[model samples]
Target chain A: MKTFLILGGGTGGTMVANKMSHHLDPAEWKIIVVDENENHYYQPGFLFIPFGIYSPADVVKPKRDFYPQNVEFVLSKIEMIEPDQNRVKLEKGKRTITYDTLVIATGSRIAPGETPGLLDNGWHKNVFDFYTIEGATALSRFLKFWKGGRLVLNVAEMPIKCPVAPLEFLFLADWFFHERGIRDDVEIIFATPLPGAFTKPRASSILGDMLEGKNIKIEADFNIMEVDHTQKAIRSYDEREIPFDLLVSIPTNMGSEVIERSGMGDELSFVPTDKHTLRSKKWENVWVIGDAGNTPTSKAGSVAHFMLDVIVENILRQMEGLEPLAKFDGHANCFIESGFDKGILIDFNYDVEPLPGKYPLPGFGPFSLLKESAANHWGKMTFRWVYWNMLLKGEEMPFESQMSMAGKWK
Target chain B: MTNPILENVEFDDDGFMIDPNAWTAEIGEAIAAREELPLTDRHWVVINFARQEFDANDEAPTLRRITKTTDVDTKELYKLFPGGPAKKAAMVAGLGKPTGCI
Candidate 1:
């Protein structure tokens, strides 16, 4: 029997396992999934946790819940991947497993320690992050009793998962403080390494306008060198400084350490994957999916879902002595939650930038594109249900893997 | 004057025909024409397959299902519809919008 070993039981790995299990014959193939954590987090929902929109229970479940019955699921930390020998070493008991095919889906994580003085005196107390459950929950507690001051939301670096999440947090923060009648007491500031509100120019202008309308300040092009916990300030490499009383920082997000140790990853520990095929550049038998692959796209759950369609189809094709198709177009769509029960949607691919247009249908969209609307907000909320039911099950969604321009305006 | 192709059809906000029964060969051609795609015999094959699948399943068929059942391969499907085959083809076929994670 051919052995298929998948590292990390996150969104990408779980979907691949479940979908591939249905395709490959049990008699000829053995699929095994290895993950260190027992609980699977809906990482997007992490943004809402700090605002008491979703409890910890809503965003987490047993990793086994999403796994297929035929796939063997193992809970263990991967120590290293020896690509040369097609073997993986686990941390516990020094166990090693060999496979005919390997998938690296060990997604990225926040490295708070990478930033100087980030984990010092005010680490979880005043300095916080909403990227993790612990950080979000800690911020939740801090916000409940503490009087508001300068609430600075800083992005330490680029390529963070769900790039819109920090923006969502800031928008939601506006709503949260307004509800508490403390909007006047709080001075909200958004600091990013990017020159504007977002990566895309069109969407950035709209979001920047929204921030301006909300009376929030944007600290554009601020590259942080260190977090000085002593003075409650973040110092940039260029000597620019931004002070804050309560800092919610998205620290440097890096791929799994196992990738770095295995020497199979880039400087950021992300596996160098073919942007289209999602196959590792170095190995024929190896595939990389989700945030683990250094694809030039947003590391969002939606992107993972889109990538899975291509990865699964390519894997099946390769098994049948066919060449894998380079089909993924870096299609990424995101719903930006603005304050006051409104949201905006943006859809783009490798070549096309997001434009103001209707989505799905050209003339009849209930959901507006690149504009804020209540319908888009409902779409954003409804996605949580879609993620747990249709997405994780690896069910075939009606939409194609690629982005469509038929209904969109130029 | 209104384009005769869109004369009698009831389209939703996204320009998809609300009533699948209202679709015809002319409607499909008109939808493709609006998008500046000239429908060849190959385009019809994929469009007919999408409509037939939607009729039976009550939902748009995935790209994988279309490629597996129809003569058009994945690459040819992308060539037929530049960006999104399942979605664009379905629209030209006068079908409802495809749902979930597009």
Candidate 2:
């Protein structure tokens, strides 16, 4: 049987395995998934941990539980990927795994050390990140009794996973502190490298207004030079200083180390993939999905989910010696959780910014696009269930792979 | 803000070029002059690098990236471009305002 090797069995890899496993004839092809960890994390749930909304038990599960029995799951650290030879080397000097095809879903990770003084010593008792389980758990414990001062949530650079999360954190913090009867005591500050609250104009203006409404001061265009723990401030490249009593850092995010070691990634370690086709620019046989590839779209789970059909179709076409179709439109649909049981939905692709419209059921959506609603919040909450059940299984979703502007208004 | 060189140019609110192909070196000089930074050899190095990067990636390179790839180190870039070297350099380079990964 021909080996279909997938590296990093996270969201992308697992979903690919789930689809290709059933589609490819078992007698003709064998699917093997290699991941360092055995546990699968519902990463979006990490956002709720600090507010005591979700516990560790709510998010963590065995990785194998999501994968079908037909797929072989191996738990090991990937040492290198030899693209020329069509093989991958594992740690412990194990026999290299050869493959007829390769899929990279290694995903991105928090590299706080990329910044000066971020991890100079042990991280500050005041400084915390919610990107990791440990960080979220620790922050949850810290936020318990903290009579907060300036709670500065700073994003060090761009291309961070779930780009809207930093704003969501501050919004939730507003609701969180108000619920605790200490809203005024907790001065929330959002420091970002972007010129405004978000990347796009309409979304940024709306989100910026929300921040203003919630009494959160936004220190926009703040590119951090260094973190001064002694002074309790972050210095920008322009020498602007934003001080903080509690610093929630969205640090520099980079792709997996294995990508770097393989000499296959960009300066940020994101694989250079054709933005539309989802195929590697350097290799015809290789495919990149999720945060692993440098796609201009928001690096998000929904984006990955949207890419699934395109990748599967293209890979299959490639196997038949046909050219891969340039089908992916960089479609990304996200539920922006603006606390107090309210959320906003954004549906867009490469050409379209998040516009005001109805989605899925256009002009009759239970959820409103770019407008806050309770229904959208419910959708956001329900996504956790959908993520585990439908999304990972590569099941058919209501929306198509390409974004449509059926009911969008200018 | 009122320079004639900048008057007809299509640019965003942050003063980055809306269409990169519309950029000319003369306009780059005018942009640099508007920022109260006279175009020097040092400044052009950063601007050239930024322009080249924007052409390649359709996005301007970060200050850290500029420093790492070019001969000009971090402090030197700050000294030459002063306030926000990367964005300022991008603006002068006739590149669009970079929205990292939206």
Candidate 3:
């Protein structure tokens, strides 16, 4: 049987395994998933952990629970990928495995050390990152007793995963502090590298207005240079400074180090992937998924979900000696949680920005697009269940692989 | 309008060129001049790389990507284009403005 090896076993890898398992003949092909950690995290739920909306236990499940019975799950560290010989070497005790085709889903991680003075004694004490479970939990603990000062959420660079997350954090912070009855005491600040509230113009303007409404200040065009521990400030390359009492930093995000060790990645350790094909640019037999690929689209789980069908189709075509289709159009769907039981939905692709409209059904959407509604909030909350149950199983979702402009207006 | 690169050149409100195809290396030099930065061989390396990336991807690249692919580091990017290396690099490279998503 030919082996279909998948790396990381995260959202992208697990989804690929599920979809490929159902598509490929089980008698002729054996699928294997490799990961270092046994627990699969509901990463989107991590955003709620800092606000006490989600506990640590709420977001985690054993990696074994999700994969199909036919697929093999290996728990071990990847020493290096010998892509030249079509084999991967696991850590010392685990045996090396050879594969017919490979999938790289080893996603990005926040590298706090990449920034100067960001990882000092004040790392998690005064400064925290909500991307990880530990950081979120720690911040939750610190925020409980704290009489707040300038609570700053800074995006160190762009193309970070869940780009709307920082804004959502600020929105929730506004709600969280208000709930605690310390709204008057806490001052929230949003410091981003971009010139506006978001990447695109329309979304940026709307989100900017939202920030203004929340009384959370926007420190735009703040290309962070260093964290001044002594001064308790983040200094920009342009010599601008923003002081913060509690610094929630989204540091420089990079891809898996194993890709770096194997010399298969770009400068940020991400596999250089074809934007349309989702295939590795350097290696023909290798495919890249999720945040591991250098696709210009948002590094989001929704993008990975949107990419699932395209990769599965391409893989099966290749198995039959057919040319892979240039099918993917950078479709990304995200629900931005804007606290106080309201949220916003955005549906977009490579050619389109988040336009104003109703989603999925277009005009009849329960979820409003680019505009806040209570239904969007519940949709985001309901997604946690969908993620574990249907999404991982590669069950057909209501959304299509390609974006539709049906309900959207220009 | 502060330091016009050429006559009859229409620019966007943000001061980037209206038409990317209308840009020449001479225009790039003048844009760099507008930022008070003279083109060096190193500067040409970045300009050339950013343009090549735009040709391949349609949109311009982020500062991180350019620094990663080229030998240019983050510190050097700041030294070359003092205020904002990304916007300045895209301006000098004659590519459309750099954009990214979450």
Candidate 4:
């Protein structure tokens, strides 16, 4: 019998397990998913957490609640991936499980200590990160009753989970401060290593304009060397220091520790993966998805959602002794919350930069692309419902696996 | 734009070789040649601007904005470029060669 082992029952693993469990015959193939934690977080919701838009309760649930009924669910930590041996070691039981196919969906974690003094005395006190539930909950209480002060939003490094989240936090903070009647007193600054507000040209112009208009200060291409928590300041590699009262940091993100133990990952622990096929570069039967894959795309939930079909299709093809289809186009779409009851959506694939377009349908989208509208805001809110229901279950979304460029214009 | 050592030349729509263009022609060409260029030039403005749009707005800016903001018009911008500013800049940036946004 063919045995399939999926590591990390997060977004990628759960969806793929569900899709495979339904398609593969039970008599021939067995599916099992392993994860260290029981909680499944709606990571995108983390952006709203600091703003009190989503409490910890709203973003997390038991991982088992979303697993397919027939699949075996193992709640344990991964000790190592012995790819040559085709086995995975469990940390708790110290047992080894062999598999015909293995999928690594073990996502990333925040590494605040990577920066000097970040995890020191001010670790969760004066400086905070909302990437985790505990951090978000703590920050919410901290932000509450916190009178106006210099609030610096810092990105420790690139390749962090949910790249736009920091920007979203700034936008929401703008709204949050205004709502609190402390907009003027609270100084908001964005310090990033990127030359501009973003990686792409068009959106940067628009969003940069928006940032300037909103009075949020931007420091570009400023590589942070250390956070001097002792002095309440961030010192860039060039010795430029930005003093702050409250530091909302998006710490550096790295993949699972098990990948490092097995010598299968880069310095950041991200698995090197085929951009289209989702297969590990080290092994034939090994696959990886989500934030675990070192693919050059925003580490957002939508990218994982877009990768589901391609990964499942390739996995099935391997079983059939057929060439795996190299079809995933790094498809990523996201909703950008631009304070004041408006948001924007942009959809594109590997080769295509986002264009001004309508989504899901041509010229009739309920959401606007590249242009902020209230409908897009509504769409962003409604996605929480969709994620809990359709996405985790491996149900086919209305959109196609490959990004459609139909509604977009030059 | 032409690179002396890389044997690389800028191209137009028809794949015809072309001359250097843009506010930071020397730097853009240097990037294409795998050489480091100063990041502070206004030449970065277009690529940076385009990347910003691609990230937040997720679309390449129209030729109009790319020209207006970067101080390089469309004819010059599209010459060394292929289709979009992001693709061109990403290739020149050479940071793990973009997987074509797929």
* For model 2 chain A, the run of ten residues with the poorest summed lDDT: A117-126
Collision pairs in model 2: none
Runs of candidate 2 exceeding 4 Å displacement: A121-124, B1-24, B54-59
Evaluated at residue A233, the lDDT of candidate 3 is 95
lDDT of 2 by residue, A244-363 (tens): 899999999999999999999988899999988899999988999899999888888999999999999999999899999758998998898999999999988888899898877889
Name the fnat for model 3.
0.67
iRMS (Å) per candidate = 15.2, 2.1, 2.2, 13.5
Instruction: Choose the strongest candidate by DockQ.
Output: 2
lDDT of 4: 0.79
* Full-model lDDT, candidate 1: 0.86
In order, the TM-score of chain B in each prediction is 0.90, 0.86, 0.86, 0.38
* DockQ for all candidate structures vs. native: 0.01, 0.62, 0.58, 0.07
Task: Give per-residue CA lDDT, model 4, range B1-102, as digits (tens).
Answer: 445633454544432223322224444556544434334444466666755655653334544346545667544554445343334555443322332222
lDDT of candidate model 2 versus the reference: 0.88
How far residue A125's Cα lies from its native spot in candidate 3, in Å, is 0.8
Candidate 4 lDDT, A155-267, residue by residue in tens: 87777787667778889999999999999999999998666777676767777888898899998856677888678999875557999999999887888888888899865
Q: Alpha carbon lDDT of residue A342, candidate 3?
A: 96
**Could you arrange the candidates by TM-score from highest to lowest?**
2, 3, 4, 1
